[model samples]
Target: MKKVKHTVKLLGALVSSVVILSACGNAEGIYDDKGQVFRKVITQDMSSLDTAKVTDNVSFDKFNQVYEGLYTAGKSDKVEPGVATGEPEVTNGGKTWTIHLRKNAKWSNGDPVTAHDFEFAWKRVLDPNTAAEYAYIMYDLKNAEAVNMGKKDVNTLGVKALDDYTLRFELTKPIPYYKEMLAFGTFLPQNEKIVKKYGERYGTSEDKSVYNGPFKVKDWAVEDKIILVKNNEYWDKQAVKLDKVNYKVLKDSQAGASLYDTESVDDTTITSEQVEKYKDDVALKKRIMPATFYLKLNQGQVPELKNQHMRLALAQAINKEDYVNSVLNNGSAVTDGFTAKGTADAPNGKDFTSQIKSPLKYDVKKAKENYEKAKKELGKDKFTMTLNTDDTPSSKISAEFIKSQIETTLPGITIKIKQFPFKQRIAREQSENYEISLSGWAPDYPDPMTFLKIMTTGNTSNNTGWGNKKYDELLKKANGELLQNAEARNQTLIEAEELLLNEAPVAPIYQKGEAHLTNPQVKGLHYHNMGGDTSLKYTYIDKSIDRKTGKKKTK
Candidate 1:
């Protein structure tokens, strides 16, 4: 279901003991002699690298480096051509696009990349038998919906390979961000031979998959480390200076920081508890992303959550500003709406957040009044439920803060706090085992649709079991008939968000911010708020030495 980046769930109550790992700095080359090797840490093991199956950021980050799509995101979020030679030839009123492939593009195995690869990859994702979680991303293509629903043959899909180096796609309507969307990993191509050979074991480990980008997976030790080396056969190998890159998996936040401090790792993300410690450090960098950390209220499990007033009461009871400033003192911002700022703006240059009419606000008196009304409507003065969340230190603190705020604002409500491992939490959510769960979402694209489309009827990611026919109709038009009119499309998304707000399927908490400590010697690191934040194609280590002084260049 394209799990949210940085979101996890713990299995049970928090354990007071914190284990420190014994230093293996010597056994593992903390820093290679070449000075061209870079190291980083990941909290969780990667899920997959196959274009059609990979859903989470941990896997997508590596995929972004090892796979090339039609376009690739570079510095400042620029969409640069990858497999495509140049910008597409748009015709037929922006519905038809013809792309010329780059002649020099080659896979790691030295095979030439062709237009047929794209056709096969796209059709495979849309095929109902594949059951891909991200197949909905292609619904804008002609007949893609019918094909995915098993009502039409996969061959009827919009994409086709005109020749060995030419590809064409017929879209249902003009997409304003078509080029940007193509840069996403979901649009990447796959070799048919490799897929058939690996079968179910594809992308399970390093040796199972093939590479076509700047880097290739050299080794993957599950739950330990993933090692990547430069793809010497890549089209642009000269630009990739890094000889090798290592990603170590360490679940403990403190251990990650220690690795960075001891020169064992080049960079690592910092938890909220360590934010203050690094606030004054020069290497500390804070990135405010277009993501929202919120709670998914499962109305299917507890019918009381279905009441609009009950949901509204829960949403209004919390002080979002406090949650961001106090609970998440890591540079996050309070958000009253689901979509975060910096993702999109209106045609007139106004931000999307400024145009929306807020449906909920913070007011203790109003919250109490709504709570009373909900109690009366439900015919129960006392209500009890569980609030599930991850066992991370920050998540535990945030859940406790939310519980306190809601309990103080509403009367006769008993809440049980349950923590689970991140993976188990996702399993329970899919099973509908919890009434409410702390959840978050990161946008797949810059368009508002990335944030609004999830709650549509029957969307696999909509774990809340919420649906509205009117909302779905608005979204369908926004992606179709309203495509040509920017203002109208913007208005439709606003209206759709208003409906979501009124229904109150999720409580908006705060937009997230990333805090990381990077070694100064590591240079050219680029990031964007949306999709695959890290891009290492142009990134290189500044390992130059002064010829006369014999001193290394300072970062």
Candidate 2:
């Protein structure tokens, strides 16, 4: 493992006791030296940079800068070329894909990036010993399931390195959206040598990983600041204007906002309260993210949650509008269905809400009646449930609001809120140890199937244990027969989603919106719809220009 040292500046700490600091003033801005672009992002702690095991947005955002996948999402949320030079060619009726890589790409260590790196990375992720949370994301690849379950040797996996720059993939079926899946982080390559050198420490911290993308990690201390510097070995280095990127870890929104206000940081997201104060600022910008915040009922932990009436009552008891407008004051919009609006390529090119029955609107009368029916069905004198959430300020507020609403709307129903740190909350969620869990989903790709297919019976992400055999059948059909026919595939997906909503396995809440402030001098910063790090490959600070040479330089 290569350890890179960096200088850091201490930002103010919050009451939560998390280390908040900035990583600027190192090597004097890359833009100042070489006319490169740079961005300063504010985030909570970055748990890890291992793409396969990463779940938090903060970690993913930073990791994205340090890695690249075969495909990537473009400005229009459509599939675009990344490491690969062009779109993959389907040779055997979509079951087999041939990918031609760009010869010029290289890793940060100057090693030629090749197809073999992908093959090695995919096999490592699916190995049962890896225990990656997103392993199921690749189960569509031929033999991936068998390999993951230890029924097949890793050598039998579908991906193959035909040569130094040519790769092939065999899919279990003809999936039209398969190209979109390749854009996900799990598909990013890993340096086998680096992994072997670090062994157990591989990807546990910043020192253990190597860069193969737009940036490289530097000066990363857990719960503190992590810095990213541009990869000069990148194939498109000439196009990448960013020299150095800095991230400040601050859990409190107020403290983060203060950093942005004082010009100590380049950009930071704002809460609802801060939105009102900063909306008029010239730097404020709004982005509609493809995320759905919802509640997960743990039927395994609480039997009452298994009862259909209790689930329906609980769904109706909370007011989504109030939650979005009051609790999440930052521009979030209440969603009538699980999928957010504006998501492209939906069934019939229509929003998911358009195809579903009217959602369980907020009605105390309906909630109370259902609560009574639940008590009667359970044959209990009283019913009690606990809601689990992360200890973040936004999560705490959201949990408390739901608790108050449920207690006030439904009589004889007692609810408790349990707050845990982010790590503990993730552990409990994975173990199914909570009666109810507050969770959110940010799309890994552009397609609706990414969000819709996770509820299947055997999916690793289906920790809620919510499964419908018919829904699974529809998804399989979509992945196999209907995928090549886009229209047919979308219709099948619509049916699957309708079934999911009718079952009410997960209560849909609202589509999230982000409020953030950026320095006006920061030019060419692009926002990614998928919740990864913002890309600055084409960005640069527009300092004064050289009049004779038509060149720009930092002022």
Candidate 3:
């Protein structure tokens, strides 16, 4: 890979303001009680900010604010050009893309961001040694899979820099969603010089990285708080109104709600208990995210999980509607399919979920019959299993609910709930260390492939230890050979999803709908379902509005 000219510049002291800049005009910080510029609570501390390596959403919350990709997600999660001046010039029957990068884009260090940076970043992720979990996302690139699998060298990847400001990409097939994929974190560019300078330390701390996005990390106190100040060098900094955004880590929702009530934070997520308490509050809000929560049964730990009857029995025993409406009074809804509803609309404007027949439902009789069959096959009168979940208040409550439901429905099962911190829980699940683990997935992109492809054979996110050769073949055809045929690809993905639900490797629980509170003084805080975590660029604290009434305060 060719290296671009690297320049390092000193970052002088950032101008301090006790109050926000004139952009907020006469308005004061809504959470100004703490002398904060802007404030919000993160449910979990960030895991990593390295775009190429980080996999969790909290880490993405930081990464998405500090990095800009060739394309950026716009309002409503549409793909918009960022570093790239416009949509790529396509040729070779959609197999080749020529992107003209904006020459004005510069790194936080005043180094010019160029096409070579993208080439370097893409190849770095594709390098097997990087161990990036999202490496499979780039498999559409010619030789990407081969390179990541060690069958070919990283240099053989189909991306190249035509010059300082132009990039070319060669694809294995015509991906209609290719532009949207570019907006994802894995495709974001990195300054080769900074990466090489920091090596292992890159992105580990606030100052260890270079930023090209709307905001840069000012300070990060691990597990306590992260401070982000506006990046003046960003290409679109003119639109960034907030001088700073502070993310404080708070895992307890009740504590967060109390803070929100006292105006200590600008935003906080609420638990089911608080949902009814704040139901009449004018600031209470709800949003349905393009995310799904599920149970990952570790077939590797318990071979009985591999039995269709056993898996179905467990899935059928849970009353999903009651779980959503009663247990989780949040905006969540019961989902019968793995892919959440409203995620994708078919060609005729019908929802994708509407086209499929769900194999999952709450039927105690069916569950008992299946359980009997499973017991007969395994020759076991009773068994004890562990249910693993995160330590958050909501996770604990939900885990307890699930345990009660399952044990009551299935006569011979004893469930013990084991709780770990969010990050630790993810690690345990990734290692396939538990019998049944509660898991959730927020799609990296809008396409169904983001949700569907995770279950493919050997995919990193498939912690269930489930695989079907036919399922893999169908997905391969949907994403590759049938890439250009929308009708064919849709049907193929539908078939694959049906097979997955029928096998019940992982049981779909609910699509996430967050019922939370936001300070009315904070404006322009948008929830983008298909994009990276919300950026504070356009968000501002408008103190002129009455906090309780959400109306303009009159003198």
- Best by the lDDT measure: 3
Candidate 1 residue pairs in backbone clash: 9-390, 9-420, 9-421, 9-422, 10-390, 10-419, 10-420, 10-421, 11-420, 11-421
lDDT tens per residue, model 1, 1-555: 012112321211111022113444344553343548888877767767678985666677888889999888888888889999999999998999999999899888888889999999999999998888789989989999999999999999999999989999999888889888998888999887888899888778888888889999998887678989999989999999888888877665666777666556778887776788887776687889888878899999989998889999998999988777766777788887888888888888987877887666677887888898999999998888799997555566678888888888897887788988676676687667889998877877788898899889888678897899999999999988888889898899999999998888998888888788877667788886657778888777665743223257667
Candidate 1 — number of clashing residue pairs?
10
C-alpha root-mean-square deviation, candidate 3: 9.1
Identify the runs in model 1 with alpha carbons over 4 angstroms from their true place: 1-21, 29-34, 430-433, 543-555
TM-score of each: 0.91, 0.89, 0.93
Output the lDDT of residue 541, model 1: 67
Q: lDDT for each of the candidates? A: 0.81, 0.74, 0.82
- Which scores better on lDDT, 2 or 3? 3
Residue 84 alpha-carbon offset, candidate 3, angstroms: 1.2
Clashing pairs in 2: 37-241, 37-242, 61-533
Write the residue-wise lDDT of candidate 2 on 466-510 in tens digits: 778899999888777776677787778778877776666777778
Better of 1 and 3 by TM-score: 3
- Residues 1-555, model 3: lDDT tens digits: 001001000100011121123213423433443322567877788877678877777777676788899998776787889899997999999999999999889999999999999999999999999888889999999999999999999999999999999999999988887898898888999999999999988888888989999898888888777888889899888898888887767666666676666666778888776799899998799888878889899899988898889999999889898899877888898887898876787767798888888777788998899999999999996988899998766677788788888899998899899988887888888778889999888877767788899999889899888999999999988887787778888899899999999999988888988887888888877566765567566778788889888899999
Q: Clashes in model 3: which pairs?
A: none
